[model samples]
Target: MSATEVKLFGKWTYEDVMLSDLSLVDYIAVNKAAQSFLPHTQGRYQMRRFRKALCPIVERLCCSIMMHGRNNGKKLMAVRIVKHAFEIIHLLTDKNPIQVFVDAVKNGGPREDSTRVGSAGVVRRQAVDVSPLRRVNQAIYLICTGARNSAFRNIKSISECLADEIMNAAKESSNSDLAAQLAVSAATFQRMIAQDAWKFLKYMWVNSVASDIPPLTHPWAWGLPVTASLTFSQGYAIKKKACFAAKVSFLHRINEHVLEEFYKDYRVDDAAMHVGESAARVILLH
Candidate 1:
């Protein structure tokens, strides 16, 4: 089916859509066509063309998406299509698809240099209708699509980088709503990055692939749930508990030094010996 026909499933075009917005057929077609064969230039041309077709749609549809409106579940349909388009371009052009898509989004969004006469001899510049929401949509789409099947470390690092950039932008931006949207995406990516990082560390800990966890210095790290009793059924739970017990013992031995110092100073075994006699001209300090 044609790209034009796919709009029938989307609320962005919102005219009598009988199907859900997140349609799979169009992307399936794009993937099939892309994986088949196309010259580099031809693939690039189609990528650009597909971008043009999808731009206005994203521009209009992203408003709802930014507001957290799902548009009757069609919100992701456009994103999926763009991802497939990128996949096609990668197959045909040997370029990293996310990079290409991100570059296009940065350079291709809006231009406001056009002018026209308005009802008289005076000229006025036409407004660029591509909003911040549109740009955010494009960036989020790229990030989410790139997250699939990729190495967790790679995705986590990229997400952290994007989140930092977005947070910086939010600080400098004047539009409150736009800044809030940027902040939301930044927070989302941060949570994902943190979770992914925890997963990475947890895998290392459980498999004994690395012994750096709980650190050689800090026994406190083992107090967390990774080595907790609930995780006992896990493969490394027994090891974790043993290591924690050892660290606790080590710490207790270290504390003995403190008790030895106190004993030497007081020369008495009383634990809470008062240092001062009852009120022989004692000075009171605030």
Candidate 2:
């Protein structure tokens, strides 16, 4: 089998040492002294990528090395003779724990990422959050890198499910006004994710470098008079503007996964777009 025999012979191990008693200034110095050993892309272990992909540890170890040591004020005292020199020679190195594990469980321990299976039959468990886009306080991280990438592909599937959700919510409520608003929102979302998306991509390609296009922010106030929004022309303009912004961001990091058919998909629906516009205004007026 694999080498499972433990050969322990070292007098001392270079490991993460947390000194709770260390003064703030000394702590800062110690942290700086050993910071070079912290792994970056260049100094990574050959097994690191493999470890990130295959190692089945859920919780990362929080390790910090002693920084400030020896007698020029602060809590500077260590191994009698070589205290100062000892700190400089050994750099503190450990797995950097992400906030995902920090908030994962009340008492955090090792865990696995079930969803992150790499192509080489390894599971990437380190520095990855299981919940990519969980809504926090109902505020969406509009610029989440992983979430935004996945959303581009999966939004169509999600919008289809939302139609059923709208119907269920409508059935539960006696409020026709609420039902109407939900219907408008659902229709808007459906048009957003499905039909208009392909057309918008073409618009983006045409206006890729157009400085006149405004950045995509919350155009319609989801707060006061929630239904108040733009007409078909206005809605289309804003959507097209947002599409331009998104494409620009995607361009910086484009890969084979990004859709390459922008110039080809020119056919667009005019009638449905008009219908959506009409419906939106109707909801706002009532």
Candidate 3:
């Protein structure tokens, strides 16, 4: 019979039937023809072509089964046709056949060991101490720069060397400032340096005012403030003040909109008014 005239019967749906009755060769030929037309088209055209190709093979197999009954010969044929039908469906669907095959293999393979164990108590992470190193380093840098004075060159050089040693200790101790301090005993600054424990040396040098150098107390002098608070309008006013402080006289001549945008970008937080404290304080309070 022609491909379009064949009809699949209901018995073809059985799970464990024989393959011989299904007429495997004819099934393959029809399925091959169906697959060829699937490339250049999609949607309804694809669905129609698949159904047309598959229905005929299914119909012939069904007719064979109905004629032969439930004997071993017919059962074998039915099984083969059902298997072929499954393959055809797989090829036409969106499912990835390779992934499906791999998943099937994995699912059917051996399983890993599954055993229960008693729960352990919760463990807390240890906190690191950083204050000692910060204090020591701050002291060292202060002494080295002689608080940024040009007179005490020798003392500055000695302080810089000590600072370098402290930095190395910090690295070796994995940022453990406490361990660094313990490495260098607290008593007798000269003895501490003799033992290569320059931790307290920087502190001692900083406290000594004999060098006629002022102490650098404000940490904010090193960088911009972290936070500052001012209302939108107040922030703009502070920016204008800072501009004047910097001797930018042209700021008075600039447009208000441009000034507002500039302030929005550079204005510090209320809390971090380190460099702009005076202007920020006046504007925010007012």
Candidate 4:
């Protein structure tokens, strides 16, 4: 039989269901390449990288439904739930359920994500663009996750919950959007709090270093070793080069008067050791 002739569950027809989203047309993957009655590939695309994108989108939904909690490893159960959900979707919308599902996926996917930039002390969150494949995956994940959460400890069956979730998502009113937004907000809040706490600790560290410096010693003697140690411990190649440049700048800033005072008591070696000990102590505590 031709692919278009095949019916899902020998019932719902996969015809005239168009993907309207141009951006996800390549990644959404709604073709009849893997059309089947059961939607099981037995992990056929697992051997090759990124081959899962070739799997039918409906099969992908079924697979997504099989993840987490009691649903884990239960393919047939997932298939049944998805089939019933599609039936409900068709009943409610009086449209192609597959088209509704595609719309849901396109609408539910997140477009941007918060990411960290710059060095440890100067780090900041910036909104980054998400890949098309990741957007589709995240949309499916959120849809299934919301459905599962809604059905938990409730009278509603998972199929009904899934159907409702998809419908709401298609209309841009799903709890999946709220969940994704809250997740991103919580993560950003936590990171900001952590960064503020680190800044306070860094301020205290600078004060402690200044107070611990010997009276006749140059301030750079104590600060340089500790900074270098920290930089080397946590920095990348470019950061290391920047750290070396900073060391050179500090050396140039040291005048003949400061050098004379610095060499008077031979305290530079002791100061370097103290910095090493302090860095080691902080590392151990961390």
The most accurate candidate by lDDT is 4
Which 10-residue window of candidate 4 scores lowest in summed lDDT? Answer: 273-282
Clashing pairs in 4: none
Cα lDDT tens digits, model 4, 164-279, are: 99999998883544756543443333332333422432333344433432322233442433345556445343343333333323333445665455445333333232233332
Residue 181 CA displacement from its true place in model 2, Å: 4.8
A best-first ranking of the candidates according to their lDDT comes to: 4, 1, 3, 2
TM-score preference between candidates 2 and 3, better one = 2
**lDDT (Cα, tens digit) per residue for candidate 3, span 69-141:** 3433454444343344334434554333222221221222112111223356753222122232233233233
- Residue 193 in candidate 3 has what lDDT? 21
Tell me model 1's lDDT, rounded to 2 decimals: 0.33
How many steric overlaps does candidate 2 have? 5
- Which pairs clash in the backbone of model 1? 21-74
TM-score of each: 0.20, 0.17, 0.13, 0.60
- What local distance difference test score does each model get? 0.33, 0.29, 0.30, 0.65
Residue 266: error of model 2 in Å? Answer: 7.6
Give the alpha carbon lDDT tens digit for every residue of 232-255 in model 1: 466254444444343323322334
Model 2 lDDT tens row, 1-286 = 2243211111222233233322221312223223322222122223543232111111011111112233222212212212222222222212212111112111111111213335676643222222211211011111112122333457443222222222222233222123233333334434434434545544554655535433445433222222336577766665554443344333333333333443235232333233344434433443
